[model samples]
Target: MAQNLDDNYKIAYDNKAGFGKSPALVLIDFADAYFDPGCVLYAGVDDALASALRIREVAHDKGIPVILTEVTYQPGGRNGGRFFEKAKPLSCFVKGQKTAGFAEGLVPRDDEIIVSKQYPSAFFGTSLASTLTAMGIDNVVLTGLTTSGCVRASCVDSMSHGFITTVVRDACGDRHPAPHEANLFDMNAKYADVVSEAEIIAFFRSLKGEAHG
Candidate 1:
């Protein structure tokens, strides 16, 4: 007989990971090149931006460690390696350019850490894994642009690094819905527990209470 998504897909990959006690908030590439309507890389997914802002508010309130990533490259894009060759859009991140910086309101404060990366996986050549480990972070909450690319890669790497990964579904977006939905579904099944922004906010609030009280 036929079955629903739950009985078929969900049951097999029924690993629903939970939020860890010490989870770091990772904002991935929420930069001008991705959000500006005038820019070619614009994803047309504004909901994710708003959700990410809300998530950031709670992250600050809870005093959670917030980390951010930027897709920056050198003057000739020499540091990006093969990735710099493949995506011409990466030229937007050349240093000293207007579009190379983080998007407004997504800026990192003095206390937060900003990890600049040249590839999709933030942990590849960066000190992300070691930084998280140093901070005693056992879980990672992800929010960012391009769900199918950097977000997906980071989720996989986060799990492989032995950290519980959680992707705020509404806080991530793609240039299109097809890859966006497909990647989120796959991440929930394997790499991360794709959850709603409300769920993530509740989790942050819970942590705030524990941290303060």
Candidate 2:
């Protein structure tokens, strides 16, 4: 009999980081560029956004910190560096463009923190690591657009930064199912635990229960 893929990788990549004492929700680059139909970067991930919003509501009620990320480039993409030059669609994120704005229904509350960057990983060249450290956040629940890109980048960096990272499967989307599923499998194997949005919500509720217990 042939060995299944999951069984093949199970022995080596089945390790789970689980949840840490403190978890923060990080929504990466849920920008209008990915939501706007006319935009070159659009991925048509509306269901993903809806799921993330539901997760956000539960996280907010549980007093967990919510962090949002956005990408912006200067005129002519000067500050975007090699990444901007390489990814032409990134022009949608140039400063002051409507496509650079957060998609509708993702309004950040006064208490929520927004981290803007010109790169893929939310942690790269940003104060995100320091901010998480300062807040004593030990785990991260990640969601957003483009599972194969920013989400994967952020997942690896989140683990590298010493946080227990969890990627919400239903709350992330990609240009196609191929990369989306592939990246999720890879992240689950090596970087983070890929779980469902319901699992995350239940975890948050469990925290609430612990607090009130």
Tens-place lDDT per residue, model 2, 169-195, is 999999899999999999999999999
Evaluated at residue 161, the lDDT of candidate 2 is: 95
Each prediction's RMSD to truth: 2.1, 2.1
* Candidate 1 C-alpha lDDT tens digits along 21-99: 9988888888888778899887776778889888887887888888889888899998989899998898999998878
Estimate candidate 1's alpha-carbon lDDT, on a 0 to 1 scale. 0.87
Candidate 2 — what's its lDDT? 0.92
Clash counts per candidate, in order, are 0, 0
Q: What is the TM-score of each candidate against the true structure?
A: 0.93, 0.96
Evaluated at residue 76, the lDDT of candidate 2 is: 98
- Candidate 2's C-alpha runs over 4 A off are 1-3, 209-213
